[model samples]
Target: MKEYASILSKDGLKIATFSNHFRSEKGVMIITHGMGEHSMRYKEMADFYTNEGYTVISFDIRGHGLSEGKRGHTPGYEFLMDDIERVYAQVRADYPSLPIFLFGHSMGGNLVLNFLLRKPNNIRGAIVTGAYLKLGFEPPKWKIILAKLSSSIWPTLSQPTELELDALSRNKEVIRKYENDELVHDRITSAFFVNVHFAGQYAIDHANEIKSPLLVMHGMEDRLTSPTGSQDFASNSGDNVHLKMWNGLYHELHNEPEKQEIFNYEIEWMNKLLN
Candidate 1:
């Protein structure tokens, strides 16, 4: 069953969140959707966890999906962090005795990883998929320099990230749904891009600060976010981090044919952690 709720962010943005309950509950998982998508996109993934006796919770971030805010805009990185913190607090309060885990993808993964670095809380662990540590392709040097220069003057100025949708998934239905999804857009504010770019690199540099056991997964063939970044982070993130590289898989591993295998791996990982 999917239930919805709304909460006010520190900066007064009303964020939208959802909870999907399983018939039998073992624990709760909080999912974070990637850029240009909403909480609903994770229905299948959440349901998979639900069937495994886990309740799932996820939110549309301040500027995305059904959430209230300017599309693709943010006040600052600090503002975004506070919004995530508010969601974490609410979920933690609701499930006081249940173990909590986090799952974030792409841009959401970047924020979730940084959230740990900012403050390593009492959460059990995390799973990051196709995290945006470094872009598989970078924006032009001049454009990035200019965006940084003008960001303060015009915080909401839109810039296209030039993400290749074709590189997202091998499944036709998944790609089509994403392309036709009205909520999906490639334009993000100059300020948002600058903040995201800096934060992605910062998360890697401070990987050791991550206090939770982490499972980091990326596709070796991922042309969106550089897989090497994930590899490098896993290599140096001490013994607590486990890295998985899916050969020839696209950015959306959940949509791939081998998704069940990955899901089984997640089930095993989380179950062991819970035990």
Candidate 2:
């Protein structure tokens, strides 16, 4: 079953959500999407999980998709965490008795890791892909200085992300679709950019504090976010955390040609954890 709804955020913003339910679900997967994208983008992955007897829940973060907030802008990092907490609480209340796992990609991956470290939760495990721990390339020194300066005064000032579209996936069709999608944006605010950049490092520095099992995956050839970040994170994290580097794939592993194999691996890992 597929359902759509909206939930009010803590400060009274409407957050759009989507869910795919299975009759006898074995578990629940809560997905958080990356910057400039919405929850609906994960339809294929959600369907795969539902077929595997798991219900899936995903929400557009406050600033993206059908949710309310300035596009690509948020007041601060705490608001982002509160949005995740709201969705998580709803899932826990609705599904009271199923194993819950969190999955995040790109910026969403960064947020999930930070959330796990800073917030108290009972999730069974988390899966992170292409987390923006470090950018594949550094920004111009002047641009960095400008962003820092503006972040304090006009934090919500939006700027184009200027990402290379081709770096997202090896599948040409995926890039084509992403390029054409109206909901897919390229805006990022100074505050959003600076805060997440630092938050990524914070998650890495405190990786050892994470108590739940973590599966950190990144594409070795990813030009969007550095795989070394994933490498460093898994190494610093506890033994329960594991890392997988996909060779030749770009940033979006779930959208790559070998996505099925990747999905199977994730399901297998989750099953092992559940057992």
Candidate 3:
């Protein structure tokens, strides 16, 4: 069954969520969507997990989707992290005895990594897809200095447009739905970029402290996040990490042609952990 709801974040921003609960209720999986996208996009994934006897929970992050805030903007970088914590608390309260897993994609993957670093003992395990541990194209030192200086002076100044590929051209239907959806935000703010960089740094700093069972997946052909990022995370996260690389798949491995294979792998991996 599907249920729509909202939770008041610690900062008082109401975060919106959609849930699919299994009758058997083996456990719970909390999903966080990528940047510029809403949680509803994962209805298929949630259905799959629920059929596998798991309760699925997905929420739009603050400043994105139907959540209360400006589209793609947060007052502070920690706002999203705090909101995630609030959602986790709500899930824990609902399913106190069941195992909890956090699943994140792209920018959401980055947020999960940061969250784990900040609160390492919160969840049982985590799955991160297309996480940006590090960028493929590293800007020069001068450019980094300039962005930092400019951000300090003008936090809202329009930063360089990072929209490289025409994401919509590949899937017209998905793009059309996204563009027409009132909850989706296409424009990202400068403060968002600054917060992203800070979050990335925090993950790197505490990579070794992440002791939970972790699964990191990335597409070899992913243009948004480099494979090196996943590699770095797996390599530095001690020994309790599993890394999966899909050749020829783009950023969204779950939406690719071989999505069934990816889903099967995820199901098996999660089952192994849950059992």
Candidate 4:
């Protein structure tokens, strides 16, 4: 069954949420979408989890989707983190006894990792795919300097993300649908850019501090975010993190041609943990 809801952020932004609740549920999975996208994009993924008897919850971070906020702008990175915590608190209040897990893609992956690092929580496990730890290509020094300066002076200054649309998946249909999705955007604010760029590094540096199991996956052929970032995180994170680098896949592993295989792999991992 599909359900819609909203929650208030610490600063009073209305975060829109979507969920798929099943009659019998093994656990709750809260999904976080990447930058430039919203929660509804994951409805298909939610359906997959619900079919396996897992209740799924996904939300639009303040500025994106049906949520209320400036497009591609947030006051700070902490606000975004607080939004996730609010959703978690809500899920805990509603399903107190069930194990809760997090799934984040791209920029959402970055947020989930940072949450695990800085926030204290009892989530059973976390899955991060194509995390935006670092860009696939080196950013120009001039652009970096401009972004830092702009963020300090005009934090809300927005710019096109310049993301290569075609690199998101090998599926042309997926790319076409994404291009036509009105909710899908390519804008990023200066504050959002600088904060997330640094937060990725912070998560990597503090990887050893995570106590719960983490599954980090990245597509080897992904041109959007560097897979080396996932490798660095797993290498530093001790035995708690399991890193999977899938060959011939792009940024969105769950949307890839072999997505069923990827989804089943995720379900199997979660099942093992539950068992």
Best by TM-score: 4
How does model 1 score by TM-score?
0.96
Give the TM-scores of the predictions, in the order they appear. 0.96, 0.97, 0.91, 0.98
Task: Provide the lDDT at 111 for model 2.
Answer: 96
Candidate 2 residue pairs in backbone clash = none
lDDT of 2: 0.91
Compared with the true structure, all predictions reach lDDT values of 0.86, 0.91, 0.79, 0.91
Residue 171 of model 2 has an lDDT of 93
Give the true-structure RMSD of model 3.
2.3
Candidate 2, position 146, lDDT: 88
Per-residue alpha-carbon lDDT of candidate 3 for residues 1-275, written as tens digits (9 for 90 to 100): 27889999877788998888553457789999987788888887788888788899999988787888767776667788888888898889988888899999988999998888775445778999988666656668886777677667776665334544433224455556655777666666667767886677668667898888888999887777778888877877787789999887777777766777888999899889877
lDDT over C-alpha atoms for residue 151 of model 1: 89
Measured with C-alpha atoms, the lDDT of residue 103 in candidate 3 is 95
lDDT of 1 by residue, 149-223 (tens): 878889899876667888988888888998899877677898898898889989998898787999999989999
Model 1: residue 47 alpha-carbon error in angstroms: 0.2
Q: Model 2 over residues 1-275: C-alpha lDDT tens digits?
A: 26888889888899998888554458899999998988888889888998888989999998898899899998889999989998999999999998899999999999999999888899999999999998888678897788889999999899999889999999999889998898888999999998898899999999999999999999999998999999999888899898999989999999999999999999999999988
